[model samples]
Target chain A: MSITVRIPTVLRSATGGAATISATGSTIGEILAQLASDHPGVQPQLFNEDGTLHKFLNVYVNDDDVRYLGGLQAPVADGDEVTLLPAVAGGFA
Target chain B: MLTLTSEQRDAMVAHCIRNLPNEGCGLLVGSDDGVISQVVPSANVADSARVYEIEPKVLLRTFRAADDSGEVVAGCFHSHTHSDAYPSPTDIAQAPDPSWHYVLVSLRVTPPVLRSYRIVDGDVTEETVTIR
Candidate 1:
């Protein structure tokens, strides 16, 4: 299955400034692995040494969060769009 | 420069003020050029005086409204209850769209201060806020 991954601004450097990229994978985990292989610079930002998605990174398949859709094991199909967003917190000092 | 109408600016300020000790957050809707046409006051689901989380239901509704109105989600707006109108490190790290404007309102001073910024690759650059 072909999936399009929307790259967030913070991780764009890894993709050579590309806003989106397409890769082949049957599941979200496979797609991410292929993406990391294609752009090694993003591996550290997307996953930890334990090979799991970083705590602050939130992945969404279309409009549904992957965490609610079986996470890495979530099945992916052709023309699926995945977005990565970082969890942000800021307010009063 | 980011352009905002006086009424929209005032409404945003009022929303922040109404939130009191808690930080207020909302979405800025407009076209791709940073001309904000609407201020979508969203609920701060974080419920903490020091943090703000946009309510998901409200967010969905806001996006739908923007779509129905032929506007794009251009930026984010939030208030700092007791801090400067600047983006914190967390904000920088979480900035998802390089093309988006980050509008901040600070209620720390007698008159609330408002600022706009573009955060790209961990860099924060302040932009001019043109009130029309």
Candidate 2:
């Protein structure tokens, strides 16, 4: 299945400054794996040494967080759009 | 540049001040060009003077309201109880959208200082704020 992956600005360098890219996979995990293979620079930013998604990054499929939809195992199909967001820590005293 | 009306600016400051010792958080809604149409104040679940978390339910409701009004989530605003009106390291790391205008309100001064910023790829750049 083909889908659109929205790359956050922090990871745009890996995609040669392209804000969005197309990938093919039956599941979210597979699509991410393909992205990593295509843009090696983004692999470290998205995945940990243990291959798990970084805790700080939040993935959403069509606006709904993936954490609520089975995480990396979430299913995907043609035309699906995935967005990545990083958790912020501010308001420090 | 981000434009905010005087009332809008005051609303933000009031929300932050009302929270007092606890940090306040909210989302800004408007056009993508940095025109703030609304300041949707939200609950700070963190309940800490040094931290904040926008209540999810409030966020969802605000988002829906903005959607219905044809406004986008232009950016976010939060208060720094004792720090300067600037984007902290954690704010830089968590900026999800490069297009957003991150507004920081510091209550440390007698007259709270408000600042606007844009965070892209961990780079923090101050934006012009026009309060009319």
Candidate 3:
């Protein structure tokens, strides 16, 4: 199944100028794995030394916020979208 | 015009602080009345000098899903990695759809601080951010 994973500006370098990428997977974990397999640089940005998402980062299965659902195991189907948003911390200077 | 509950306020602060050194940004769901339901972190637009912009698709999805969830788009929350909790000229100029409670999360200072506001045209009014 094809799905779109939107990349936030902070993580754009890992994807090399791509704003969003399409990958294929049946489940959320599979999709994430595929994304990692496709973009080797993206792994550290999304996961930590423990292989878990950084506390400040969150992934949503079509904006449903996987944390509220089933987390990394959240299901995904063809045409579904996944957004990986890392919590931001900056403001007016 | 709205108030955040204790839990909602805390969640936002924690999310902001956890991402220190870089600008942390995110979208807050739940109506003004239900301000504690959703807090999805977003990108910082990669510029420390400008007001944060919610990612286009992420922004759309957050608000759209919130609408579908029967919740009003209350406002958006972002942090100040190294400044006071106040909106800047960029924030005032780029303020979209007036009803949003432009929540400013302060991470530069200790104990952390949060202030909510409504910036329209150029007026900035601070609102009490609380959770109940």
Best by lDDT: 2
Candidates by TM-score, descending order: 1, 2, 3
The lDDT, on a scale of 0 to 1, for candidate 1 is 0.81
Residues B24-97, model 3: lDDT tens digits: 67777776563557777776555443445565457657655875787855668888777788987766655553
The number of clashing residue pairs in model 3 is 13
In order, what DockQ does each candidate have?
0.30, 0.28, 0.11
| iRMS (Å) per candidate | 3.7, 3.9, 8.1
Clashing pairs in 1: none
> Per-residue CA lDDT of candidate 3, range A1-87, in tens?
689988765567778879789988777778777877888887876677787665556677875777666766788888998887654
**Model 1, residue A4: C-alpha shift (Å):** 2.9
lDDT of each: 0.81, 0.82, 0.70
C-alpha RMSD values across all candidates: 3.7, 4.0, 11.3
Candidate that would win on DockQ? 1
Model 3: CA > 4 A from native: A1-93, B32-34, B47-51
CAPRI class assigned to model 3:
incorrect
User: Judged by DockQ relative to the true structure, which candidate is superior, 1 or 2?
Assistant: 1
